[model samples]
Target: MDVDTDIDKHFQQLQDQKRMLLMAKSRKGEVPRDRKPPQVAYHQFMMSHMFRAGLAQSNENMIRSAFVPPAYQPCTTPIMKLQPIKINQLQLETHHRGRYIVLKVMTPPMRMTGILALGADANGDIVLLHMYNQEEENVREATDIVDVGMIVLVKEPYYKLTASKDYALRVDHLSDMVRLNEDDTMIPPQWMSRISEIHDSFEPHKAKADASMKKEKWWKAIRDYTAAIELGPPPDRLEIIKRNRALAYLKTKQYDAALADTGWPGFGPQPAEKALFRAAEALYHLRRFSESVAVLETLHATFPDNAQATFNLERAQKRHTEEETGCYDFKALQREAEHICPPHLDHATYIGPIKMKETAYKGRGLFVTKRVKAGDLLLCEKAFALAYVPERDEERSAGNGDITLLINIETEKGFMGGQADLIRIIAQKMYLNPSVAPAFTSLYHGDYGATPITFVDGNPVVDTFLIERTMALNVFGCPNSSLATHKRAMNNESMVDNVYHSCGIWPQASLINHSCTCSARRSFIGDMMVVRATRDLEPGDEVTFWYQIPHFKANMRDKLKGWGFVCDCALCQDAKQTKATVKKERTKLRAALTEKCNSPVPSHKAMERLIDKLEATYAVSPDLVPRLGHWDAQMQVARIYAAKGNMDQAFKSACKVLVFLGFSLDDSKKGFEIKKWGMVLDYLIDAFMFIGSALIELKALASAKKAYQYAKTVYRIVVGEDETFEKTYEDHVF
Candidate 1:
């Protein structure tokens, strides 16, 4: 008995020693990395066992259900099935012909101006149904609700002779079609059996296609859908498959393929109205504005009340007009830009005569093929990809619950994740349209090297790391125009609480070299970038735009950090040669001039001295200073002259500023207004207002009235006609 007790005590001592060792290791933070504690081990073991059992049971249930199909579940609402008529038995009789028939969709619904489908009855007799003049609400609701293998009850469907001279059914009203669920008892057993077989054959491919779509594997989705389509399901199912394939093609930027799938034969007129609309959309993207317009016009003639058709038709017409005329109304563009979420301008492309050429040091640079005068449109580019950065609070809710997932993208600004959001969107776009991957990858990735991953569906997937580097080097930050911001401010309730800083990629614009004294200026109208020559340039002159303001106080090294290059532009080179004494003198003069301009009532002598000093500095070292700074100095001098009631001097000084802005203001004219001012529209407005106010003080009422009128015209051009501007100075000229 004593020996038995001693053995038990020894076992207890061993157990205690094991526990103590474990506790010491844990306290020292040296717990065995691969081992779990007893509690955790037990919990994990139970979870694994339960998971296995549940999975087994699920598989068993699935197997059982596959063999013995569940009973048809009826819809909660009672539906009376009209007497079904066989497809082949239809006759062209006024009363007896137009009867209800139950049919299953064998093809996808093809949309043009209307939804078209070919459905089959239990007898395997097929008929085409053209649902035209569908209401917008009904079409939107039907997008997800209508699909292949759907059992629908058609009521009051009239027969029509197609171009092929075949009899078909026409369904016009939304009420005429009632789509029944898979388990609906309304489906005939004979039809159900056939549908079940078709479903079984197509299920695998369909599932794969759906999974690929969710993963944004557009090419895979297209391939799978095409395979399923070739299997020859019913007419409605075929249409559905074709539609899905078309969507995949569209996402991949294969506009031609998309159009073909929408029912446009290689050589023929437009297909059904439903498919025609899609063709028009594809044509629009391909920049075939005229073709798109023609199709839209035909669709509009058929369904004048279709809002979407009308809207697209008008847009096509506008794009066609712009392409032909090379003219754009800024007022209309501003209105579009003011939207919180603006529609993409995918139809816009590079419209100027510029080409990319390799440079000695710079990888590539844009060059002018023709002489460009000041204010000439150099390049108008649409963003390849873009995103609006929401406010801090709204960032959590901005995207479709994927915002947090996207925040993991690495960026230089580590904790500041706004750029990650933009790159995330670019990645999503690339995923949807893998064909654009080449163009996106062709962009300079700065210092970051590409880390290649395994190919997906035979195409290399874009790395987020490459995208982050490219975006950092090339993204343009566009602020909302003052006019847009002002309009938003006017309507408090309608205001978009977040001020979105738009980031966009202009692949072509990214080629323009950087210069402190740039010859071109860029502006944004929505996501579209419009670049105009700030100075005249001869043919073969490299087009350059300022990446950073020339007057910025930072040295070249500091300013060029983001650009990842030392600017060897003329201005920077000249700065290197300038004497320290001259630099100090210039800096002091600039400070004095700035102080004078900020004063409420600056002396005319002091302003004159400031302008003189600026002129001297420019004359001595033209390359060291920007002409824009000189223009600003002149503007201040003009304001000082105007304040001193020196109208003549003010007009002359203002004209100097106009010359720098690429405008020739002739004071000898009655109105003293040029036909066009090359200055930015916003600055032009201010210049005219200042000139008009000075004229009013000079008692030149007639001239002042003309100036005000010009201001009003410009105001109309900048802001849309929705709001009227109250005239500050009124005059009546008979």
Candidate 2:
């Protein structure tokens, strides 16, 4: 029953009303007068609070009797009484919505005498009184003078929805003249202050502030803006202010500031072709290629016939492409992403090798349910979704292959900064399953990749609700994930990461949660992961993968909390605990490793013992294991082999550990999977390119050539130079 509690409950009801608005289709279904319900709710909650605060029934009755104005009684019976309130001191006005106000009665013969006034109770019955503020002889004669200082007395209840108390009172026939004393007239300062405050907070004040800079009172005007801003005006008002500020900035020659303020957030009628076109021009002149491209992109979408937007977009794209190059090496890219290519696709369940769905999406391989080995043949997938982002420069690039695979075109296409239509068309093609409710409408770019599509001609129907339940059952970023990032063709900045990493459908593969140390490994059979046991797995163990960028410490992990749902799996559960007990043991091992490396006499025994202890420490809590810890330990072992002059042993350990590391979705490889034979083929291409540099470092070419030839052969097998594959290959390889 506290005022704050009352306010809070009412606020919640208001919020609920707003939320229900989205599902409402008609005006009748709309929330009934926003102000009324909350006000009533607040009043009720306040009463509850009052009762809880120990105001007993008798006490409340007495308070109500004392507080309730006498005129509020529900009755139309006429009564004669001395009018205590003056009308002259009070001014009243009404707002657009229905609410009433009246000045509290303060002195006898209050303002405006000889007025018949009515007051109403909850039932709207009127109370009437007849009185005059002045002498009866003077009141009737001064019909033309409704002076400000005069007092009027009235009897009876009146009901009306209006803010002005004085306006609700009307002068009716009192034939006798009314004599009034100036000392008896009333003027209400409180009523004037209320009107002044409301006016101060109105839109006109905002317009005044916006007009201030032109009048050269910028500082004073901006200071006045605080009140108007606190009581936020409509978007149109803000736009006008922003536009004015932009012009003011332009006059000062602060072009960038002007442009920034003039854009959508500041002064946008964004879809307006002229506004966007001009903004695009400004961005281009400023050489802000990305921003210019964005403006042009919006303009083009709004009015496709606008040649200027099209031209500007092309121009901006060209500039962007030219300026942005060498950020990544394609050969290295293949190596990094090689893990997406499994040795052989496990399609033991292939049903007649489903062909491509549409001619537009050519050579995209079909669904073949066969279990391919790590190095077995999976059907060659082509592009089922194609997007050509025209750029002025030929050097323009994309993060993934141009065409991506999909389980359902409608559901799987990501929402990123490019080619929204590409995603839209695919989403429209999704099968409508009644049971499948949408998990999220916004697509995060990281959620999908060029994963393999299962069906070509036929749509692979999936229960979206099932997917939602799966995501819920599994730990995702938010505990309640109605915002699954994969449902929409595009989302703004919010859903980018999820969509960007989204590859083809590994329906089963997607079930594995992330872990720092994963037992199961994902290798692209063709478009999907042929998930296999990288290490021996016991039955009944939950499969997991590292949800985070591996190799990061606990602090880094903490920083990424909201990126997705909080993981409550075994590994994450272990990570949440303190490592106080294990710290000492880890420190001791590290010291030993350093001491053995630095000593005048190398102690092999000491190093081996230290490594053993480190392993023991790691085994104590599998959940406590940091991703990089194991890989670093492996490297130490490899180093020991290298130092002992065991070249074969050292090389073998290095290759084994590096290969495993390469498969990791960690900071080093950025989440690009690098496992399986076909992946090795892709990796070898990079190995061939980079091995020469390493070969010179190690003074070995024979080993490097062997690695290169091995990669070349796999490429020849998996990526055959068929024209159909080649035609769609460029866009489908990322």
Candidate 3:
């Protein structure tokens, strides 16, 4: 007995240590990851240890003697047969049809994906139902995800083997599930609640609700309002009470609930101006700015001279413009980035002359509708949701700024978790403001096979698991608009390169496909992702950007392969045609030159020779295909030449750097014709700055001013905002 006790104690200590380690990880601005369980056959899951032995019997007994209400025949699925279900494949199998199933609660609800409970049909055949009220997840601290002991009429119940590896019916759409009340006449005598015991005077409850609202007790107000609503007030009084309850919901930030209340039956086809205004308020709070504008417009049509409605209409209009045009006070965004913990900006997203077009290479990609100059703003998008890990000092400075870390509940240890919290945030965003659902679900989701968002009762159902998979592909880690922060980030200062302090989804930017020779560039101003044209683009030109920079000379193809893409851009095409031995020789020379350049006493002649050899290895002309592998070496040599007081050679080398980036030179006149944009490289700014300085020394003022302006243009495009331009280059400003 002593030996057994000692062994158990040792195991317990190890488990405690593991828990501590997981807790430590969570402190680094992330929660422990949850591993999703693989799906299994319904029959197999029913026979598992979970549903076997005493558990199945215990669940069955819960509904054995208890009466259940006759469920509404809203919809029904094909009877899910008992265990040993098999698939008979056809050449073209029928899809899961829209259906519903009525079930009596047979077991206490458990939190699996959302909330799961065993439900039995009249025939005693059982299935698991998972329910979640998606929109209120972020608001109410004590919201019940799913209620137990209720007869639910589930429309279009999605039957699938869940992440828990069990076949279950998942209902997420508000319209999809009809929750039957215990007091309804349809319920059997034993199942129905006693009227006298449960009923409350409507007048008293409503009065209390109004009193609580005045005292600013939002939840108390909501509770009383709900109770009064349950008592079935007169139709005229009910409308006023519901609108009041909606105001309370808005105050508590339960936006979806507020929106639903505004849509209640009493608010019907031609609602009063007050009712319309209330609906507009809910949509505005929900971030459906465009929809809010539409509602306000309707309200204005009815009550044109109403002062309160007029002010709200203008406010909604301004927000709508911000959303459609992406115009914002960037200086404000900069200030917010400095102080805001997660840096979620309140700017509207702007999309320039770009449109999504079908492509041969990547299925679909962004393209220009009209000609755009280099540095012209293309798209500026606000993040739908951001998961940011602030520096510890920043965490404290932001005033106990607790960043919301999403922890997945299913996994035993969330060691490998990355996107769980973000996924949930995005899911909730879609659930509440489903007008943005089409935009979100249209992004690349690979072949994970999650169903499209289903609409029930005009409300969209949210599938968080689908959101998780989609977020994994589209979330971007980037720097803010501050040049100092961006420079420091590049040099491995406070935030590391591998895992940034922030990551988020910028919807419009996600449409861009990758190309080694990129035509556009993307940067961030707080949560706003700004994209600009790197080259002058004509109408119908495809816009492309690098998905990830290829810093390596070798394994570039392998890296592309890993991303499941094959680039046929000018540079990639040139690389494809080049001989392996010749490329190998160039790589060796580039490596040697890099080492020599980094040394204290370097042979300038040998460095020049290596650069000349590397540039020579490119089978295509620099004007045709920009070289990415060795631009740094050439730029470094240009700076060295200028430092050595060789202005002419430095200017030549700087011009060569331009060629390397596929920028066509127009020294024929003076400055530049803003060369054909090839690919975006890190050192282009340095190259232009050096060229401008060298031009000044060479007594070429016209060309020099042009270089300075070009440098400033690149600065705006790369750094994302212009407030820092003069500050960044104060001494060198023209």
* Per-model RMSD to reference: 20.9, 24.4, 11.8
Tens-place lDDT digits, model 1, residues 1-734: 00000123234434444454344334332212332343453344346546644654453221100000111111112234345676666653122233567887655565433456667788776676665433222213334434567778766455544333334566533344666644456788876665543343665777788898888777668767866875677876776677677777777666767877887643235345667677788788866788988888888997787799999998888887776655676556655765645436544564687889998897799889898765577776667876554323354344312221111111213212234345545765664445556666788645564544424323334455556557767777654443554344444435343324456678888888887666676766667777777556788888887676555355775766757788886567656776778778877887887888778877768867776776676443332344455567777778878877788788777766766554655674255756434433335555667777777766777877776665664544343221344522233221
Off by over 4 Å in 2: 1-415, 418-423, 431-549, 552-616, 621-627, 633-734
Candidate 1 — what's its lDDT?
0.58
Worst 10 residues of 3 by lDDT: 63-72
Per-candidate local distance difference test: 0.58, 0.35, 0.63
Number of clashes in model 2?
A: 108
Q: With candidate 3 superimposed using the best TM-score fit, by how many Å does residue 676's alpha carbon deviate from the native?
A: 1.9
Which digits, one per residue and each the tens of the lDDT, describe model 3 over residues 1-75? 000001232344345544544443344322113312323323343454265345434433221010011111222
Report the error of model 2 at residue 339, Å. Answer: 20
User: lDDT, candidate 2, residue 461?
Assistant: 27
Residue 126, model 3: lDDT of: 64
Write model 2 residue lDDT over 549-580, tens digit each, in one string: 44324543563453444545434554556386
